[model samples]
Target: MTASRPAVEIFANPRADRSAPRPGVLTHEARAEAQAAIRAWPGYAPTPLLDLPGLARRLGVAAVRWKDEGGRFGLGSFKALGGAYAVQRLVREHGGDVTFAAATDGNHGRSVAWGAKQAGARAVIYLHAGVSPGREAALRALGAEIVRVAGNYDDSVRQCARAAAERGWQVVSDTAWEGYREVPTAVMAGYSLIAAEAVAQMGAERPTHVLVQGGVGGVAAAICAELREAWGADAPRFVVVEPALAACLLESARRGGRTEIPIAEETVMAGLSCGDPSPLAWEILDTGADDFAAVDDAWVPPAMRLLADGESGDPRVVAGESGVAGLALLLAARERSETWAALGLDAGSRVLLIGTEGATDPEIYREIVGRGADEVAGTVAR
Candidate 1:
């Protein structure tokens, strides 16, 4: 398929307050605490940081590194850290009997359900109409009671909130709204575990750029906060990439505040098809993110295929639609000389892209990459 070129928006975050007394949403202490807690969890291990020398040569960059979260806890997404950790915290603070609820396109709901089960709590997940059956089935497999809503992802989030309020269930959401900051704060802090691992793995070598996928901006904010804490004034330039159809972060950055985009159609990037920016996330990303770029859905599949097939000698990676967004944006940017220069990307640039998921939806994965995730993983293993 001939993918439409991505539209790039380069912005310097003027409001980015990298100052101390960091936003209460996520702090260095919270990140360290989360890292310790997650390390103690069963099967908790740092995901691989893959060096794609061949891909770097092909893209004409000094180096390209991929943080592979596809195998994170075997849940197939980095969200396993966020929702599960938040649910565990809530269960420990409140009680194991507390019911948890959240809205998700896919991964977060599964994490919530898994966390609830592990914590001996009940979970109900709300899904928008656009979520595929495979995704819903995955949540059901985790024992979450599913509620299908008629609207988009934001609508489902609202439904989840309403149901949580009426039924007295605790909402373990990744997105934040007014009077709903703490849980999402915890979620974003949990995500800082990823940044911590990447930083440690990079050792003395730091990338010049870090491309993060933008949803409600939780992951991007968490990564930016953690990187700033680690690298201080020398942190890599952080870029946020999202689907063009649901570019809430881009819209919010353009407007200079938290803003919502009305979703007219669903983008293939189910995980990133968010209409609203999380207020808690915006608190950090407003100044933390360096640039925001929106890509067409068509760019996603080729990225998934490229990772699965392994460019040059890079090992095959199983990144899903949402997981491949950063790489997709990077690939798209390389085609435009002006966009590449604006980001300061060139032969001497070292870049890091987070593959936030594997084939969370196996059917869609097979269709896009022309092979199942298991097949690619097994091939890579050999």
Candidate 2:
């Protein structure tokens, strides 16, 4: 795995707050193209913006909402939004009638495989051994070849990048470096579609803040960047949340310079347990994020259960660990009322947290939620 590239090189302009434009980031035209490509994606769902009235009651906020990405496009996560669009853009520009490849802890690879299938291409997905069998099976069921690597997500990314270089396969990765910005940019752009849809879904009442789950930081950057545009001078407060084991952005932010956190990433939220941020994502986030937070593995599960168990007799939300971990930030935010007080959140403030994934890794989810896979599933469905 590569060390974190300097944020200045990637983003160039860093601002104290996200409201001002950064220098040399994605151009408006490029963003528009990405928006168009994401809309063109087959099986794309403008996912629901769910109201969590009970959770709002708990947080003492006016409202709480979830952007549900579970079971989106048959993959159990939101990473597909970026992965699939990246694959389509790469295949269209670079080559066609060929194969697409990616390395992911779970979601991104599944997305690439799914998109390649739709685009009439083949795919090879590299996964670390930590990935649950359920996720592996899901990829294989989509007709994509799954290769088990022996290390963490960062290791798998390196392995996949090398193999793609040698085997003449196109890689649609969310992480990027000097010469690798093309696909990562497309990936980030594709991911912006989420916030695009989300901003529209909000209508007149915009969210006061967003709690976006960070893996390689692609989706977080995408969502934050679009919010920058949608909200313009008054963009919502952007917070990047991650597993404690892999707070590359948080650690980097602390160092006042870029830092590569070596992650023996041990979390049930495998999707966010990534070591390095995409260079592009790092760039956007370093300048755009108002603050960063990390939560322990213990916080991930109960939150999953809380969502999957439903609130106030509603059907269960079926949020797996990776998805629901985003809301753990809400819990912490409420716990430290002072943290949000300065951000101006009160009962009238609308908060958006992503339910980013479904049951992509059921074993991990069950272990986190302290229930068998089937035990509480019907509750979510009912």
Most lDDT-accurate candidate: 1
Q: List candidate 2 segments past 4 Å from native.
A: 1-15, 22-24, 336-345, 370-382
lDDT of 1 by residue, 43-128 (tens): 98899999999889988999999999888887889999999999989988998989999999999998999999998789999999
Clashing residue pairs found in predicted model 1: 16-287
TM-score of each: 0.96, 0.89
Candidate 1 residues lying further than 4 Å off, grouped into runs, are 1-8, 12-24, 379-382
Q: What shift in Å separates residue 147 of candidate 1 from its native position after superposition?
A: 0.2
Q: What is the lDDT of residue 41 in candidate 2?
A: 61
Pairs of residues at least 3 apart in sequence or in different chains that clash in candidate 2: 62-347, 316-380
Instruction: Find the 10 residues in a row with the least total lDDT in model 2.
Output: 5-14
